[model samples]
Target chain A: MSLQRPNEKLKSDVLIGVGLRHQHFTEALTTPSNIDFVEVHSENFFAQGGATQSVLAQASEKYAISLHSTAMGLGSAQGVPSQYLQKLKQLASTCNPILMSDHACFSWSQLNGQQVHAGDLLPLAYSEQTLMVLAHNIDRVQQSLGRSLLVENLSAYIQYSHACMPETEFLVRLAELTGCKLLVDLNNIIVTANNINAAQPLDYAQQWLAEIPTTMVGEIHLAGFTEVKEGELIIDDHSQAVSSQGWQLYRSALERFGKIPTLVEWDNNLPSWHTLVAEADKARMIAEQVFGDNHSSKVTTAMTGLESEFIHE
Target chain B: MNNNDAKKHSLQAAFEQVAQQQQTLISAIFPSADSEVIDEFDPRGMAIYRNNLLATAQQALAISFPTVLTLIGEGLFNYASRELLISSPPKHGDWALWGDDFPSLLTNLAQLSDYPFVADIAQVDRLRQQSMRAKNSVIEQASLQLLATHDIDEIYIELTTSQFGLNSNYPVIEFWLSHQQRVVSDTAEELNQKFIQQSLDKLVQGDFSQKVLIYRPYYNAEIRELSASEYAWLTLIKQGVSIGKALDIMTNNNELEHDFDFAQWIGIALEQNLINHLKV
Candidate 1:
């Protein structure tokens, strides 16, 4: 059977947002609703009761909320632990998020019978065995939430030789089995492609894109990556602005995906709010250039912040 | 186990090998502890996972126990936290509760002996964090009525889950009180200078013994010194003692030893919301 696809939710235009950051909490609340939605990590609001929940409520008030998670180890061999799942479910019900997403990697594993949290997303082997486990876990999460989830790919530094299938193929099979959506993170694809020396990386990206049905991809993630001192590995640290190679790849993704909801995620070395808003505007402008013919009038109406009355000086 | 169980067990076993033991996963793409690099991938690739684990543990400890970090300097703190990371990795995905046993790290390190109270401060840090984030129980209507109707000998009293007490040989409460600013933003060197300028040694100089009472003060943990009878009564109640025996010791009405103002004591307990309420 073919991969199940959800109906398009947002208007085909207005395709970009910046992840809501506590550093930019003041600005996020005050800044005009230029972006479509603000994504917050679901685990941050797991407290019994605290100010962080109120901050999230305020952010939700201004823009649509996307509960992006980092800790739910969906690819775990044992399974997603029930406690983390319960917390995420509560957050989902509370926020009524527009979209929820997490990495297609394991961050928790069972040592004997005890569940241990890795706290960072660990890559999985791209084999059918691994795929089966991941598919089962993803289905569990989606069923429990009563909503579809968009699982992103891992920017793995190492690959497993036993991974008989390619990463793209694994994801395609996972989506077909679980009815899950994909949040294709371009920078991760770029980072992994470069690190793997995939001959022609862009063609490889296009090749992977070709293998997966575009309808299954619900969102796009653009983030900055840093290369280590030895230059052998490009770490997806999400520290800086999106690189030129990353931006070019985004254009390719936009050309193929056709203006899906995109997010600019900068977690470390956080820039000022103005700088982040500019990055969101850049993504919007790029998408406008790609889909300008059908979406020009909508783009004019979406003029916000610097793109509007403030600066053209 | 079935085939699915076998495959799942194997996956978890391999994941634990890397995550818990810091050993490389035995994948051809990763080095097998020995430097056998694959054809295209670099051997250093596995270092990324190791580095990610380190950064994650380090950052979690940084937020949960900022007081420890501030007291011991960043370099030493990071070093100690890394050691603690390997020894006691996170049990749950909640980073807020990740460093639950970090105080033991401070108490065990020999280099930190000069500041014996630092471990207590770490505990204070944890309790403060828990108190601030967790909603405290309100005074239970049933509990108050039950307490009012029943004589001290007729009922058993218990402290709320939010109340904690530490009887330390050192004046830890004063030391903890001196450093309880909610946020620990100062560098260790700066904090050390402040510690010296305030002659903080005096806090620990007295009989060098004290009892510290910890309970929810509004949303955060409030650290205060306990009176002789308050401390005795709480200890007895905490041990599940019947109120009669505790009262005998508290007021010496049965000539047990001493005397306390029972009416004033109950009023204070009611005001502080320290008495446990019925669970249902």
Candidate 2:
């Protein structure tokens, strides 16, 4: 199959795949339905010769791969590890992923002349200095990989006291300054809203959608979150089913932002392959509902070895 | 406040301050605290941090040490994990590489110390991980041809990069394999040492020290359980002994039969890509 361009607009019906776990690798690769793209965790494939690379190579021949990362630590004070970035770049070159993205959280804290693995993506303060640090990091990442990186907003539990602009503005400014696209995770927005006691997260989302340049939004993420107690909700929990409220918010996002590449992430308590496909089908249905049936036809065209020009305006 | 510097310093300071107070910080975000932060708009903010921290750490441990998690059910595993985290917090950004010390931590647990196999299982788990991420090397077919030049009784052989040596005092490998056959049923019951000793004796013939050759010619890492004699033969060969010298030692010790098919064994090793290069 011919390679597609990164800047090309994917069809509205396009449903991107999430990281494939060992449990679902066989089913995912052999499934009868045609998936538009397959995403993988960069760290999972760091091994030299393993089943992960073998399966990914096979899958790449059949589908477009998106190399998503969990350990880039792009926003850390110590900055990105050179070895990790080099390895990731090498993997990207070999796999030929369509896009690369990582969380906007810092996980590293320098201590005693060593960069230790903190095991978690800690929250960051939304300030100009932090923004500069992020921008420099993003620039380095993009330059090193020779590809524009997409930074996904993390779901945070705490907010800093430093007076600053809203997260939406911060992200928009970062994208504007660094020339990186946004991977708008609707679940994170919902989680942040619940954490902050925002009366209307949907409205906040709409405002964000309006403020951020639509062209800069490369992809969207939808995941389920559970309500721990009464009013608090955690996004991207990787457990439970995607709530209707989140789906509704997604629909609203589609209406405002138009068709964008979307992924359904069920990382933990992952169900069978059929369950994941069903979730993807749900996302596809929403896509069709907002963008019309012609969207799927275009998607089919792209799947059957057609050029991007055929589907794009 | 020159708009830029003020924003940068203030935000950095706030984050540093918040991260310092782990408990109160989580309570502030999560609002799951017994009481709410009345002054701030974000009440249950800390709860998010707490949940994320615990959940991420739990998930990392769960992935790294599946056998331990399985031995203890999810509830108890979570409890043990929480205790472990409080004592030894994660110090890095990579979650996958996190919990490198979890196996040792579990071994030190007074509750878990009775099961001597737990630590060995952890060792096996780490070995599996190392095998997965180990560097790639190509085995040479020419290396096997050297075996044909010398008489079976006179040659010393060597192993190459495609091989891995695992030395263990316990039947950790067998324990892991059996545990994989069934989900751990009860954590409250004490391990039966007599039954374990019998099984270990049958597997190792009362030999506590054994050498296993782990090599991956293709995709999966294959473990070949070697006898003490075979291990010695392989070790000498791996140390660059000429094929003739290695075979002489094996034959002198009666470790090899007169009719022992050296060619067939060499062929199998070649097919498995265990041979990399020849010294002679």
Candidate 3:
């Protein structure tokens, strides 16, 4: 039930990976040569008897893995859902993922007498009020999960008028008060800055990362977005390839945070397995360039036996 | 409650209210919701989140009931799914096993009156999803020799949680298989319409009975057709009845006019790897 088992060997340097989408599961079973790790949405594998679990068991044999979730509702008033946390803890124990994380926003709320899932990640106000809420829920989650979890900052569409504290201070305070680290999604920062007219988007992202030191970042996520509504709002749809601007900010983030575990999060319009591995390779190249010889071989000697047979292919 | 507890409660209450109402969430959080807002805070921004929430629920339904979508066509299927979202939002964050109520909801749709069989057929898809999610029992291999060794009255058979058999008045199996994408017919629409008519004709002729057995022997969903009496015997075994009691019930039941061969049914079940194991 203990959670702090970091893969120091793999975590020795920045490792690259992609979200394990269903389209890529079969090819992933082939255990391609380049993938450093594979991350699966925790909710998808909650059911123990489905094909998702069978496929994940085979994939975990050959590749390093992580567990990312969007249903934690870290800011909900209904307290922590023991059932959701129970299943998540089971999956984490079974897989022993390199890292476990969920969004920093609320997705559950109490409506009348029933607990309702908002069906999407809803933004939380970055004021003194929500800061305490998020911290308390994170403590409960970390206690039950038996690990220090990582929380990703959300991409907001509107700034809160009543939220007295800035978003950076809120994230910093959460990490300081509770033991959880930040998941630092680079693309979300870009999308939010452009939509909300924060100074220059990349500069805004760099400034935010500057506030949190390298030790506090657990992981980084890069996903795609498109500006719709006459270029007024940038939606994090995850359907397209990551934009050129996103890549630039990603490089800046790597320079700021040094070498943290990074992932390409293409959730919707998923590409073929080969194409996804290539995107992970692209993240690898950026990390290598930024860190400058602080990294090891691109394809490390982690797999043997059956993994060797397929990865070599 | 302490100040922190009270603050959290108010934040959650406000959030729950905004989810049900219009995107007044922005206005509640920031007065920018009312003004010609700044670049990042468009009033229409809430609509995008609204669409994403609806789309998430729709995609979940579409995944669970792909055949139903093909039967109703994508456009109308999208319409029906959205309507269901309006009528019933998800009550929890864990939606992996959601959409069990969808088949009943589909049957109540006024637009689907012409395709009354669609709802019943959709039930098969739900069964398949459930069967896939059912706990996989690690059963020792079942053998007729082992089963024969026990006195029929004294023996009990353990069935896996992943098996289901249903007998319906509609040609549910035919309707389901006809809509599956594997059939490779360019005129699938025309074929579906013809199959629908034939299914209805069979129903009117009082010969439209379809028997289906769904199970997840392996990790994947496996479905096959069964004979009428075979369905009855399997249902009895699934209910934990002793083999002797099951046979007696089958023999005593005068309600079923069409008879089935037990030996042939056992052979079918064994070949399909349907039974989990034998017990005494």
lDDT (Cα atoms) of all candidates against the true structure:
0.72, 0.67, 0.74
Task: Please give the lDDT score at residue A54 for candidate 3.
Answer: 81
The C-alpha stretches of model 1 lying farther than 4 A from their native spots are A1-12, A110-115, A227-230, A293-313, B1-41, B136-163, B177-207, B218-220, B232-249, B253-280
lDDT, candidate 2, A2-104, per-residue tens: 2264533233345555556778888877865435676788877876666777888887776678888887877765667888888898899888888789878
lDDT of 2 by residue, B137-194 (tens): 5665575455567554444444545466767666665555545534334531224444
lDDT tens per residue, model 3, B175-279: 786677556666876777776686666677655677888877677677777876677877788788988898889888887645777667666656555767777
Those runs of model 2 whose alpha carbons end farther than 4 Å from true positions after fitting are A1-19, A111-114, A292-295, A298-313, B1-48, B68-94, B99-109, B112-117, B135-138, B146-163, B183-197, B200-207, B217-224, B236-268, B271-273, B276-280
Inter-residue clash pairs, candidate 3: A195-B40, A196-B40
lDDT of 2: 0.67
Enumerate clash totals for all models, in the order shown.
Answer: 0, 36, 2
Alpha-carbon lDDT of model 3: 0.74
Candidate order, lDDT descending: 3, 1, 2
Output candidate 3 Cα RMSD.
Answer: 6.4
**Candidate 2: residue A48 lDDT (0-100):** 64
Expressed between 0 and 1, the share of native interface contacts present in candidate 3 is 0.44
DockQ of 3: 0.35
Candidate 1 CAPRI classification by DockQ:
acceptable
Q: Who is ahead in DockQ, 1 or 2?
A: 1
